[model samples]
Target: MGKRIRVGMADLNICSAPDSIITLGLGSCVGIILYDRVSKKCGMLHAMLPDSTKIRNNGLRAKFVDTGLEDLLAMLEKEGVRRSSLVAKVAGGATMFNFSSSSEISGIGDRNVDAARECLKKYNISIIAEDTGKDYGRTVEFYPETGKFEIRAVGRDVTFI
Candidate 1:
């Protein structure tokens, strides 16, 4: 097994073949993986929110789906990977709390997933696979060598997307 580089909440990282990237405890937050299959270059982000524009104090580029996607793209580009060669995999976005009374605050997970889809569409990057939208939190790992995204959640079988 290669090194598993851990990405914390509201953060991002990159790796190459034989190495993998991971993020943990994703509830409403989302984790995105952008990779070039041929080159085995990969980038991962753990975004805490759907959009940074709505947050006044959003300073972290990796804290929102919109900005996080851009950050990953830029990182990949700097590593000599062509924008056209990138493909995406997304996970997380679980509605972890019951907000029946506060509808406005509910479905943050769904919103995060939607934002990820929209941002990827704008960038012309295809999301090849996803494991999103359930009540449980998740830990995700992306293997650049095989382009496999592994999803682990409590009381559930391991899944690959």
Candidate 2:
């Protein structure tokens, strides 16, 4: 197995073959993984918010899906991964609660998932797989060399996409 490169909340990382990317404890956030199979280039983002425009200069540029995807894509391109050859996988958009709140503000997980989808769409990159939206947290592991993404959650079995 290759080394697992851990990505913290609101951060992003890009790596190459023989290495993998991971993000843990995705409760109300989204774990976005982008990979280029031909070049074995990989990028992972742990976005804490849906939009960056609504927030301040919190920290890393990957704090929101909008900016995160934009920056990640740019980094991948610089690493020689063609945009047309890139594919995306996603996880960690869990509700984390069974509350009955109907307000849109209550469903950050769904918003995160939607934001991830919307942002990825801008680059014309297709989302090949996803394991999102549930009342549980998730840990994501992405191996670019094999173009495989693994999602592990408490109790439930690990899922590979």
Candidate 3:
């Protein structure tokens, strides 16, 4: 069994093959995972918001999709992962509530997913799979060696993306 690195909310981490990465309590947040098959390098980011500019304080930098993915790509490149070999998968981004008068906060989950997609596309990175949207929270575990993304949620079946 490889070491499992835990990535907290609004946090990011990278690992190599034979190892894995995980994150938990992803409600409105989005977990973006990237893998470079050739190098067996993987990265995961738990982003809470879509755009950092929309917020007054950009907490952990990894809390926003736009900023976090840019930083993650750089980290992977630094680890000798080629840009062309990077592929992505995403999970989380649940509505989690029902509001009559919707505000930006109410739409956070969708926005996070949009940001994850847009930002990944901006970098020409293809997203291979996703498990998102609903009224529940999720925990995600990803193994780079096998490129397996496992998603677990309360009262729901384990899903692989």
Candidate 4:
């Protein structure tokens, strides 16, 4: 095992073979992971919201799905990983709460998951595996060398996608 790189909420990072990236406390937030098997290059984004445009003056590129994905892709390209070789693994986006009304704000979790899928599709990247939408927070670890996306939630069995 190589060094484990930690990604904070609304942040992003990348790694290569023998290394891994991780993020914690995903509740109504989504973690989008992009990896290239050929190059063993991987990137993870902890997106807190679905869109950056929804919030004015949001300068954090990794805080939203749209801009976050764009930045991740660009970063991978700079590392010499081709977009065509990229595949994705997604986790988190738990509902986390029970809301009385069907308001837009109540569906942030769903929106975040949808935004990630749509953004990846726009980039022509296929999502190979996922663990999402339960009413629980998750912590994830992605091993670039093995393309293993490990998901862990309290009281649940660890899953590798």
Please report, in order, the local distance difference test score of every candidate based on alpha carbons: 0.91, 0.87, 0.91, 0.92
Name the top lDDT candidate. 4
Model 2 scores a TM of 0.94
List the candidates ranked by lDDT, beginning with the highest.
4, 3, 1, 2
Q: What's model 4's lDDT at 42?
A: 96
Q: State which candidate has the highest TM-score.
A: 4
Model 1 lDDT tens row, 6-125: 999999999998988989888889899999999999999899899899999888889999988888899899999999999999999998888767575677889999999999999999
Name model 4 segments beyond 4 Å from true.
none
Count of clashes in candidate 4: 0
TM-scores of the models, in the order given:
0.96, 0.94, 0.96, 0.97
Q: Cα deviation in Å at residue 130, candidate 3?
A: 0.7
Model 4, TM vs. native: 0.97
| Candidate 2 per-residue C-alpha lDDT over 25-53 given as tens digits, one digit per residue, 9 for 90 to 100 | 88989999888888899899999899989
Model 3 pairs in collision: none
**What's the lDDT for candidate 2?**
0.87
Ordered from best to worst TM-score, the candidate numbers read: 4, 1, 3, 2
Tell me the spans in candidate 2 whose CA falls farther than 4 Å from its real position: 57-59
